[model samples]
Target chain A: MKSIRGLLFTALLTGLIAAVALTGMSVYLRVLHELDVVFDYQLKEVAYAATMAHPDQLLLPLPSDSASYEREARLAVQIWKGDQLVYASNPKRPIPKQRQGLTTLYLDDRQPVMGWRVYTLYSKDKMIQVSQPLEARREVGIGMAWRSVRPLIVAAGFLVVLVLVSVSYGLRGLKRVASDISSRSATSLDPIEEAGLPREVVPLVHRINDLLNHLGHAFDAQHRFIADAAHELRTPLAVIQLQAQFLERNTDEKERAEAHRQLKGGVRRASHMVGQLLALARLEPEMGGSADEHLSLDDEAGEVVFDLKPLAEANGVNLALDTDTAWMIGDPEALRALIYNLVDNAIRYTPAGGTVAVTVRPSGVNALLQVTDTGPGIPPAERERVFERFYRLPGTSAGGSGLGLAIVKSALDKLNGTIALSAGEHGNGLKVTVSLPRAGEEPTEAPESG
Target chain B: MRLLLVEDDRMFGEALQQNLRLDGFTVDWVQTAEDAEVALSTAEYAVMLLDLGLPAKSGFDLLSEIRAQNNPQPIIVITARDARRDRIRGLDYGADDYQVKPFDSDELAARIRAVARRSVGRFSSLLAHGPVTMRHDTHEVTCHGKPVTLTAKEFAILAALMEKPGAILSQASLEDRLYGWGDEVASNAVEVHIHNLRKKLGKEFIRTVRGIGYKIGDNL
Candidate 1:
């Protein structure tokens, strides 16, 4: 929930304040130094002026009127020749000096403690000294420092205001984009308008638009599939309804029986189509499955063959299976369905007396599965179309849902398998070959065989 | 009356053909648009019941091709394409009517009869010429206000002739209307059906021109 404008405003304002503070501090320090320079110069001027007159005139009362005022502002002038004090501006606080240059006196020869900026000079056997109290320079420096730092403080305040206003102004485009996205409906996958957007944010918006385009395409494809599935279901349902109506209205017993038979067949076809459609819907999304179960391809294929043996026998078709140790990790249901559909389609399409053979072989890297049937094979031109959902070969009499191969394809995709179709046995039947990547870690020996 | 059904799905076409037959219309079925074109060129179907999703040369192509040749047979498109735009395109391609799939068989039969009737400048399913009155929907006929039983072929023949009274249909055209392909047409099947129709509707109801055809006359 952190706002970019707020953060920028805070950082910039803090930086400006720090810079203004440093500038103000340096300005105040420089003013104090300059004030000390002026005070030191004045002290020397007074000491030299006393020497300008003759040594005898140094005893006359120098114009150090600062002593007439408060004690804090007083400038005391001292003249002495070899310890015989000649003159003193303030007799109560007489300045003492040992050096001929400037110095401060905390305790003069007999006076109490008081600090001073002292200037002492010896001219013609007479020492001239000028001392100013430290308090005087401090008051002047304070007055000058205020004048120097006030504008900087005002500018810092103005800079803070400027940063806040500009930060908010610069972020208005982002705010507008957020509101635009929030106000849209879930189904509105239209691309966001990039006009007038800031440069740094353009890449992010472009990526979002790309994602939206993909989502829109996915939604469209899903919708089209559903519509096609529903449409395909309608014809079967219509047949069932019409047959039921005919069965009800029929008066002749023979016709009634025929209608009843058709009704049953229609219901069976409709139910079979529904089951296949459900299998496809369930398998399409979780491709390869989120949770894969380690299972043997041979075992699943054997299970499928075992289940379909009765159907094969009834149709007078011989069904057989041979397998080797082939292991894979995938959704067991998808695998089972895949094997079941391929075999079931072969059995249904093959005429009576035809045979279907399923073989599984593991070649270390890929698990190979082959299903060959003595059925009327697909023409080379139509081999690719058999995998499309609801596409049926012309004049195909088998009562298939038309989704069997489509389901098989989806299941194969889940297992990361490839399927190839070609003529089987003297070019008279269909052979579907599937190869799935084998799983790792082989057991010491093959456990079961059937 | 006879119809040509252009549907690819065998079971659907078979069931629909049977349903239409029970409704007293002879229906000839073809699985592809090419076959439909062959059938259309050879026979004179009263109306065309077309399915759009054929194996090749879709019904839309057949429809436009036939209409482009100025063939005026009424066509009713029965299809799974229920979109509004599809319907508009179908009608724009010169189809007389459009019927969506999974439709009631009875409604489809009625629509077929209605379209066929409109094509012949008739507005009702019942045809009245002289003493015979035939109801297309009920497959019932009455002569001089008395109910008379007629076979499906008999009803089809009388309806065909009664479409435009006094309009002569040649013997070959009469046979075409009376039977679909694969129907065992007796050597004199149309003659037999016409004789039966005449017996049921009175002797003078249908007239035979010497070298031409048969027609129902307004002057009974």
Candidate 2:
């Protein structure tokens, strides 16, 4: 994997190297130009020195050929008195008289070479000239430029090492966090420790820790739900097993007939529990957030009441619906589950000849649904606890999986709605009120609806 | 045997009561702990089947109450709570046995019989006196090595008498053992059953104590 430390180190190193190279070249050219100017000045000084000398002294040639070979090859001084050569540093070759000023000229026609930087000045009847080979000046200029750039090359090497070390040090915390995460077990959702972290990485660590906290809660809830579901399923299965055993042992036709009936009843209860469990699982928050369409709360309530009317009649509970056109945005199946559970719970808890009434209508910009039943209402303390999964009111003889209100609560959560349970009229019954946001309404009404 | 069943689920409780009745047990089923407590105080049960979850009062509270009152009725806990802690708590609270729900009916019946046997200080399902032998599980009785069929009521009465051989049992006590709370019995039902049992088993198998009740003679 490409590491952040490596990327930073490489980028800094490349930038430094480019900067060093650019500065090195510019410094070399500047040093070379300065060196040329200094050399020309020295040449002019040499001509002036010669011009200051006596005329007899200017006419003298070199003392010996061997001693003058190296010096004469690089520097040639010559003097002329009215077109006559009076002094020459190399007597074997005649010096050319050039204009009286600094100038450049090639020395040999057969072997071409950049010849000289010559300085000539006139003194009375004499011309004093000083010249140096262009090659020699170029060599000196390059040597001074190298001296200036050598230190920069050494500093560039040092900078590369420094960048690598500091980048690694700055990124150690990130590596530690990565390893800590990789070493954890799959079931571990503990928050990552954030101590001693760099400020650059603090926000990332905080986000990860938050995610872990949420995951831990989700996992815990899932485990509890599975355990409760299994526990609930065991009772009816035991009943079925006991009934099966009764059928196996009983020989009397009358006794066998009763056992058969009970066995069927056990199966039915188990099947119903299974169905409710599936509905609850499907309504979980994680499974929600799919596309929702505009649905009429009144129409949904009417359908639920129509379907449960036969059940209400069988139990001798009066069921009624009072509703108007109330539209909402929600999943149809989830809304059905919500309505079904509310009405079912009411009918089951209400006594024979009791009343269960449902109402749905638009109040302001919110769709309000109310279910009032002349049944024993939940106590103030138990109203909140009833939404817990598989939690049944103690001493209640109702035959349910205890998932009805829990399912209702989950559905309401999916619909972005709120539910409140309070005492009904005269404090003799339970009243459940649910409010959902109206579709195609201004968001200004949402806060009030909630 | 007469058993008390305390459970909150109406359908499961009714089915279990019916199944227990078919297994030759007269079961009185109550949907709440309050009713169970009332039944326990008012009547005698051979065993009590308790469920942990109830409408108002938990079965655990009822079990504790029964124990605190020094009631010696054997109780078998039948519940949906199968956790180890719940099992330990139920047994530690003085239940004779513990069974998780979805349990085999045969296993539960056998456990009930075992607990009842321990309570009565008897270890066998067979109750034998003279030439008659009855197997509780099969509800089969044989006289002089020949199988004989008896009505459920007659069988119940004979089993009650044979439970304590040579001990006089009043008609009321025998009727309690032969029927549940809602069953209606004729005034001479026990007498008619004893008469039929005597005719079928043999004339001298059971003896009637004048104005008291009936018994099986030990010397027969």
Standalone chain B TM-score for every prediction: 0.93, 0.96
Q: Summarize candidate 1's per-residue lDDT along A162-230 as a digit string, tens digits.
A: 877876776787788899899999999999998898887789889999999998998987898889888
- Spell out the clash pairs found in candidate 1: none
Output the number of the lDDT-best candidate: 2
Residue A438 error, candidate 2, Å: 2.2
Cα error, residue A337 of model 1, in Å, equals 2.1
Best by TM-score: 1
Provide the DockQ value for model 2.
Answer: 0.52
Per-residue C-alpha lDDT of model 2 across residues A40-122, encoded as one tens digit per residue: 88777767877887766656653332563334336667888888877787565455788978888787877556567788899
- Binned by DockQ into CAPRI classes (incorrect, acceptable, medium, high), candidate 2 is medium
Clashing pairs in 2: A238-B102, A394-B55, A395-B55, A395-B56, A396-B55
**What TM-score quantifies how close candidate 2 is to the native fold?**
0.79
Note the chain A TM-score of all models in turn: 0.83, 0.85
